[model samples]
Target chain A: MKHLTTKDLMTAGIFSALYFLAIGLVTFICMFTLPVLGNFLLPAVAALTTGSIYFLLLKQVPKFGAITIFSLVMGTFLLLSGHFPLAIIANLGFSGLADWFTYRTTFQTKHKSLLGYILFSYGLTGPLLPLWFMKQQYIDNLTSRGKTATYISGMFQYVTPTFFILLMFFILIGAILGGIYGQKLVAKHFGQTSSKQISDLYD
Target chain B: MINIQIKCLLLFITHIFLFIPFHPVQQTVLVGLLLSILFLEKERKRSLLYGSIYLVLLGILIALPYFKSFLGHSFGQLAMVFLLLYPCFLAGSLLIRTSLLSDWILLLKKCRLPMYLILPITVMFRFIPHFKEDFKHTFRLQKMRVPHSSLFKRLERTLIVLLHAAIQSSQELTMAALAKGINQLETRPVSKLTSLTFLDYLVATSSLGLIVWRSFL
Candidate 1:
């Protein structure tokens, strides 16, 4: 319900651009690395961490404009970085949903609990669901190609499970880190300075 | 003056041509011709320079996959990279040149999309460029202050500034939208909206025709 000042609007714009640049950089790095770990790590962990940092800063800045900024930058970055068009669309859609959810959770609850909002934001990573599905399809395609048993067995043993596990790990890690950062931000900005507040940061 | 209809149709034809699986040489030639037509309209010298620069960049971009193969990469890997990157770049360029954000918004409105959804999208489009500029300015300021930070630190600082900005702006944007009478519940008749021109029809028809031809012929 709070109106953003001119300064706040300016800040939102800046963050959005940074968000785009960061995503592009991370994705570019992953492309060069082309490692299974790099693929999941860069897109999931890097992106979510950046989002969390945005939320943490937003607590003090108190601007909803950041949501739009994040969405635009991420969408543009994905588009320009040669990701699938659907991925770009998903990024925008999910970011918007995450923004709305964060806003509702913070304002409606009247507590501005960072943990709640962080969890809400993390849930919006549902866009990555398609990646997992795609991986399964790739495995199936390989199997259908009559690839050697050793290759199939090696992929099933190493590639498939490693990807899913890494993805899940990064998602959870990103969420937990974001939640912690959010709590720290709330405590610092909202002046809930207590030992309990510090301890409750992860909650 | 080029008829807007013709221009729109040309745009559609170009898009369709770009997507077809033409031979590599044919694709390059088509791309060159299209780029020339698109960029070399008014100032011959400037367009020539632009076209040359574009070709150089595009050559590098396209050759990157093959370059990797030359450096001991497999054909399949190189082909995969090309497949993933080329369409995305083409699609992005097309979207930037041909698609208007406002037009998309109008279409959404016509489809009776909820304001909550439409408003955020509109605001985001409006905000992204502004945010990018602001972040650059902030980064400059931060650089002036630190002047010697590591690259990682500099990046962190930049991100921090951006996050701060986003939190500060949304409320003002939302209020500005509300002030413009955007949130009103009154519904207007969709039939009263502006009609599509002949160009729109021509472009639509040609695009569909090209798509069918490319897909089935």
Candidate 2:
């Protein structure tokens, strides 16, 4: 396996920042505009928006550790921004899996990389894990904010098991749509240069 | 006064405090304390901005029950979250504004972190600002082209252009770093002073004290 050069690392940093910012902007907008629904919309919207950035990163640096490094940076950022530590663990786990799926693959067979992207998209769910596992903490937070008991209950009413499963399903669908869209956009816009680069790498 | 490590420690401590549930008043006090630290660092503008934002959000949160509407509740919930995250935000702002990238690099190197982690972090700090500029330029260029284009088409084109720009910029940055012999550098000399002073110890001790008191309460 070819090691990541300084150039590759630098590219990773650029795209990772782009990817992080894209997701954050989309989520922030969704949060203010849609409120509770934003939580549901987050996974799908992020997947759709950031898919192109992820696909571009893969095409640019089809190396072993790039995705993992991206995940590490994101996880550390989330951790620093006051998320539960478990979120970071989940994020790293999914991204490591993503890295494995695309390991040593050429861009010609990019579906594996698409699968990797889907797994990467699933990492968005990590930050929300505490809402289920640590409900009381959230409840206490809501209560301490002087939210009425009904408001607190109403907030969590959507967090049913069925909704959780549906969320996973939506994530999968979103990833599929986003991944395909990203591949198409990348092929249309960045295809020529990246293909030449990939050919050079493999040849 | 404080070193980069101490600043990072304060950030970590503050974020951890955010995770644990606390009274709204207590959280406000903690955020205020962190904001005062920002003021001590001479970040008056940002401190004032954050302080006002906190106050506004607090006002909305307190007035939420009176409105008794979905939108009000939504805003209330959002306000509560922002209020909760205020300290972390303040700490992050303090850290980013007060410290230099070279200082971070020096501290990371001093701790003997791996090269992989160090390089990307440095590049990330540098490129975030660069990407913002790139996005603005790309959006303007998109606006200048095909004024009659559909919104979706224009957005799609803009994202494509931005990706291409990101690639070009990353290539240029990598070349620049290579030209600077970044890989060969043993230690980068920080332009700014980073020595720990009495203030560092005082802040560190107080941060620890706050954490302990909060946790035990």
Candidate 3:
């Protein structure tokens, strides 16, 4: 296994910091400038930024530590901030999964394709944890107000379908954008470096 | 510096608290107080401008209804709306004030998360300002060309520029990462450096305490 240098750690740290800043900026914009739309797009923005940075960082550092560090910090912030605790955990878990799927395999072949990066990076949104938490809260609100079980069930029946469809739409959008970005990056700078080329450098 | 972790906690608690059935007058006052705090603490001039605009719009929304029904229960509903809006503004201000982006990555490292997850998010975070800057630059360029376009045309053009910028920047950003050798799995000894500070603990405790007190105490 290749060992990461101090440079790699610093790179990851910088990337992670940038990631948080982007989310904060968008969240603020959405909250103040576009409340209704902001509610929908904030998560989408978060996902897009996360995917982009992850791909970028992974291509540069190719180390688990950087990715790990980024996710842990983000997850902890989410947990402490009292945002959707379950969703934050899921986000962190998915980050690890996405990294493992893309990088671990690429290491063997020594060729990190844009497709693999997009697929893995974009897959992190599959949990849609935030939406799930929001839906659950809505349900809780309805049920606690003395609504009948039937009413709550009916509400979910109507809401869940729409929510799932939206989630799928956002996920696809994130994947396509992530792919485009990854491909452009590969073509632009690392055209000669394949997973195989990387192996040679390390070997 | 305001720790990102504490800011996040404050935002979280604020959102949850807003849902409670507070009286409309109290809610409006709370919203005012929150907005005032944000206006005072926010650093970015542009964000402050946008926030003030939003607050004004919200004020108009609340007042318009009141003017029509000067003494009816609409005042109460308006107050409720204000209450709901208050936290969102506070959240926005907090986002601008705290250095969440870098700190978040550090915090993630301590937790032993994987690279795949971190990479995408990091990229996305970088994209925001780039998007903003690009959008503004393009908008200015377009305005020079069509200085008198109708509002609709101007808005349409702005959207187009934003989309194009997002696509282009994402590509550039990804390539930059690749050039830096970001996509491989290397083992680095996880730093023993703790991301948490005393402020983080204080914020967490206070936020949780506030929520508990509000909900049941």
Best by lDDT: 2
Model 2 lDDT per residue over A96-171, tens place: 9989888855554668888998998888888666657777877888776677898787666655788788888888
Question: How high is the CA lDDT of each candidate model?
Answer: 0.49, 0.76, 0.51
Write model 3 residue lDDT over B1-217, tens digit each, in one string. Answer: 4455455556655666545543334433444444444454555564466457656745654443334332232333333234344555456456544555556555445446566545544554555466567657766877898999885466446644443343344444445656766554235333434466665575567556555655562
Scored by TM against the true chain B, the candidates give 0.62, 0.84, 0.61
Give the C-alpha lDDT of model 3: 0.51
Better lDDT candidate (1, 2):
2
CA shift of A153, model 3, Å = 8.8
Candidate 3, residues A1-203, lDDT tens digits: the string is 13755345445545555556556656776678754445445655555544445565666666655565556556644544334345455555656665666566645432343444444444344224443546555444444435567644543442356765785577557656755654564445444455345434433
Predicted model 3 interface RMSD: 9.6
Candidate achieving the largest TM-score: 2
In model 3, the runs with Cα more than 4 Å from the true position are A1-5, A17-53, A72-87, A105-128, A133-136, A139-158, A162-166, A169-177, A193-203, B1-12, B15-33, B39-92, B95-217
Docking class of 2: acceptable
Report the error of model 2 at residue B5, Å.
1.7
Give a tens-digit lDDT track for model 1, residues B94-208.
3344445555456447557554444545555566677668767977888899999986677666765665455546445545655665544235333333566664465456445
lDDT of 2 at A169: 88
